[model samples]
Target chain A: MAEASSPGAPPAGASRGFGRLTIEVRRSVSPQLRIGALAGAIAIGLTISAIALVLAGVPASDLAQEFIVATLFDPTNLKAVFVQAAPLVLVGLSAAMAFRVRFWNLGIEGQMIFGGVGATAVSLAHAGPDSTRLVAMFVAAMLAGAAWAAIPAALKLLMNVNEIISTLLLNYVASDILLHLLYGVWKDQDGFPHSLKYSASELIPDILPGANGGLVIAAAAAALLVVVTARSRAGVYMRFVSASPSVAEALGVPVRPLVFSTVLLSGALAAVAGFVVASSQEGRLTQSFYQGYGVSGVLIGFLARNNPFAAAIVGVLMATLVIAGQNLQVFYGIPQSMVQLIQAVIVMCVAASDFLTVHRLHWAR
Target chain B: MSLPTKAVALAAASAVAWSSVALTASALADVFKIDGPPKVAIILFGPKNDGGWSQAFEEARPELEKIIGAKIPVVEKVPEDSSAITPPAERFIQRGYNVIIGTAFGYSDTFKKLSEEHPKVAFLDASGITNGPNLESFYGRTYESQYLCGMAAAAASKTGKLGFVAANPLPVVNWTINAYEMGAKAINPDATLTVVFTGAWNDPVKERAATTALIDQGADVIGQHVDTPTPQIVAQERGVYGTGHHRDLAEFAPKATQCSSVWTWAKFLGPTLESIKAGTWAPSPYGAFPGIKQGGTDIACCGSAVSEDNKKKILAARQDIIDGKNAIFVGPLADRDGKERIAAGATLSDADLWKMDWFIPGVISQK
Candidate 1:
């Protein structure tokens, strides 16, 4: 209310010179600092969240210490954080690949569900050598994921449909299909509600003896994605198209095929994440097996800016936060929902804080 | 371990004291001892006000606190994942909470790990499958109460078509469905129960939708195994009768809910906590499968809609359960598929009871 009418207006500036506020967007802002503002925003957000906890009668000292103990001080707890973050690595890559071409794929949930269904089907379909079964399951998951992703891509390419709505709504459809199978044909006669467990011969075992195999797969995938994005010609073409569609057109890039392929590839990566989760974490398909890992992966994509290496780091951090928040709620009486609220608040404030930090606010004299 | 062998003279008078049983010598041999006073905490699978399973646990807190002589801290909405379960359990142990009660089947594996990792802390989980030297998993024989609810429901229903919105078609859920049909048959031999499996425990939207579908299909009474009272609410809206689970759901559908299969957790937990305090808490070898007589569950019955004559019959049936004179799952019992499940004059074992996947004669579902 006590500010200048315009950021760069002399007439308004003159009228309210004695009592006015001025905010000017800086000519240039570094990307590094913009990212740094995310950290700053999160720090502020945590401080505010902690204050809220205090106001709600949660002992601040206990909550703080328990959080540190759960996330960092306890070595055993760290293993859990790592285990959870493994599948996110691939899902994050999925979203990152799509974001490279500005494809807002909200249908990763559907892709993951089909990916799980595909692998489950192959495992149940027949018996084979362990390696052969693993490879078959992997390929099937990717094919299903890609096929599911193609629906929205086709919608966008053929009819210029908005992908956000189409992709998001498909998640429910996928859920219904999973329920149908669980309640119908796949229903274990031995266990009416739960589907039959996939045989051990077909499961993807851990690479290291007695260790979670998903972590090894995630690491390899991260390395491969890094090379593909940094050195591959397809990556270069996608970047060029992102930089300027007209230039990409002039340079003979097949725009439709390139976009379609990117979307397919994006879904294939996410499907792998689903496979990892089903094999390593759940070990069997249940009604609630597919949690919101896809949505979380999308958020990781945003925070990591579609960078594989950064996604790995951020995903692990988020896993720790989730694990730590459990201790906070259980031990210190903090609300379990606080963890989700703080995450959303930090993400929201990051953009505003980035802009604010880049611009200068002054009082007109 | 203290009870008279003789059946109580007055059935209705013993209604509040439904199932007071004399503990066997094996149960009296309580082996474990707590390090100090009982500092209890509860880890709930859903929000405290979830209107069902979790709320029943929360509601028992006051009685539990009184029995244990300490305030109990509770953490709600803890997920079933290991990562989500471990930290809170450990935190409770770290904070000197020697007794931890969990409410979820999903917590089975995690509770087993924690029970071993922290030998000094006693861990208990409802509907969980795992146990150790210091851990005991407990679940109720819910069919007993559901049977009572069925009687009340049949009494209230003008039309005998009862519909059920079930969660998972698991054994625990299945038992209730079968026993309900049996009880309904006891009231009116032609009464048939139709079932719809929603496949989730706590999805209200699905529960309500299923309830509406059931009511639309000429079901005048609704039965449920899902974790919400949405079915009862829907029945109330449609002017039909319904039975509730977990708590006295008549609180939600005062006019519609005639009875509820309620968890009398405090009746089981209070004495068990006292045993823990007295340094004689022997965990069950095969988990605590407490029946009506041992205080795992009971029915909240006889709403305004239930007639006095029917209420008398319900009370008599309930007394038979308490006196161990009636065995619900005893044969000659054959499944709907005409397969003999139990031999004539024989009772089903606990293992077989937990695997009751088949329906009885009058229960109709999509199969």
Candidate 2:
């Protein structure tokens, strides 16, 4: 674990020059046990999911075999995992960057949805199709996502509202607004709650036909964030703000501005994910445009411990588990609810691992 | 079977035969055929007991199993994405399941691709648009049955004002709403249908809200084109009359469901599977569009709230539909915009019916 310091600036306002006594973290004596604990916790969680499924009537043996096949055997299935991972990587990058500064931006889903709206609106505006349309759509989508992300940021700073609650609840508002438009203003004459299909010139061309070409953006974000977060001054200041807010304030770090930047960038990436998905195969925005990508991004971020690059890797792995695990429902008669249960359990394990991997508690003064 | 049940079953059987009357195509020189024992597998787009669209298939699985003389395996919650649809389909094929049944419009493209890739497997998708030599898409003419339910709604209504809760305004749902209005007019000339599209297939909360909103706005009877019996359930809670889609909503809200446009997949899928097994299966190029006479959708009619006389009239109207004595989207029709759509002597084509975006007179909707 990285030690906390006033990397951003000099400690500004400590009249006594000595701050109040505080507890500090040291590396766990048995640091090696942390891996074992995390792995064990994950195993237990998955085991519980399996046991519940078996009790619900799925054969235990078949479940085991399916997991093996899902994880290793089928090359085609592995490719699909990454295909689904495309949006997750972008959204996860968004979440990872926010988490680095302790912004807790749970509104990634809504931000992504707004992104889709912006892109779709731009596409519908007859922006002359293809590259022109793609560029405009991407810009509009990023701006829309940033705008939505800023809402919660403003609320947090002005009203002292908890972002977790505001961002989570706002997901419903965002979806409802989408529904309103789908059913009302933006509705196509086709009667389905979807937008008009993008003309060939309106869609972003794919780098590879099956793989979403827009994932290049996600990869770029990962690479760029790896630098900005680890090698930049803002990155060091962000660590202080996240580790100790009082320390960051005393160090003359503008916490609100930093938080604003974190959430804004996070929102833009999530919106990029929304654009990639809408343009991927759907060709048009449909009712299920969200497709759990936003929440999955949060999961990937936590699993990757706020590292943008790791978030991209974890995104693909998580997508693999989801894509392969869903088949268990089809082949083995396990319910979709069970798959969701397994995910919930895995997230809990990840959260626990994050705790165990950082910040040791001490009692002696 | 009792007389009504037997009559329905007979009509259902004949409907399948009559529906395929126009469908006469030969398979490609190299086409897939079932081996020794016909093994069947089904892929569902949602949970088995979704209480609507998917449930209709599950409800008829036993009959399908019986007719084919084989046990069928079913997988649920398969998404519309190609990757999600492909793996389970391949797994079933690898396990020696020769015939695959899918239930989703999203499955159309993937089903077509899979049909081409695996020339040995026969694919049947409900509501799918894409088709290959090995794949055939089919959907029932729900409007034909929904029209009858609309009649029931009108007959049950204290006021001539009715409300419709719909999932999207697509052609299939549009035809149903139009027919529903027509049917309502058949009972009461002045009856009006006010439709509220909930913009989803399975969101019960939205359905309930739509239903309640309609009821609040002087709609004595509610008709639903959305999945889930939520509209019917809401109708029952509010002590109002309602009609249902996909399956018999009477099972969910007995007192409220006056009529239901129900899928008789067993009666249809059974014979279709047999045709496939006999090596005479001809996948239609434009897809199979069947009505009451062809066993796509039929009416589960007349709750106690509807008089016996109305029930008899509803049954008679159904018989008329099954015999092709009437055409719903026929000539002399004008959209609400007062533009002539079909000539007096002509009828709407399937393609035209699917792209229907206009409303007829007396039908008010957000679309």
Residue B195 CA displacement from its true place in model 1, Å: 1.8
Candidate 2 chain A: worst 10 consecutive residues by lDDT?
A1-10
Q: Report RMSD for candidate 1.
A: 9.0
Considering summed lDDT, which 10 consecutive residues are worst modelled in model 2 chain B?
A: B21-30
Model 1, native contacts kept: 0.40
Which runs of model 2 end up more than 4 angstroms from their true locations? A1-34, A53-63, A117-144, A154-220, A245-247, A281-284, A354-365, B1-38
Candidate chain B TM-scores, in order: 0.91, 0.91
- lDDT of each residue in B205-267, candidate 1, tens digit only: 999899999999999999999999999999999999899999999999999999999999999
In the range A1-365, model 1's lDDT, one tens digit per residue, is 22333534643344454776567766677778766777787788778767776777777776567656656776556666667777777788888888877789988888888888888888777646765887788888899999999999999989989989988899889888988887668876554444566677666676775346877887788888788878999878888877786789899988778889999998888888878877666555655555777788888888777777777767776777777766667765666677677566656665467557667666656
lDDT of 2 by residue, B46-156 (tens): 888898889889898999899778778788877776546777787777667889999998787678877766566789999987776678899999889999999999999
| Local error of candidate 2 at residue A237 (angstroms) | 2.1
Local error of candidate 1 at B113, Å?
Answer: 4.1
Candidate 1: the clashing residue pairs are A206-A213
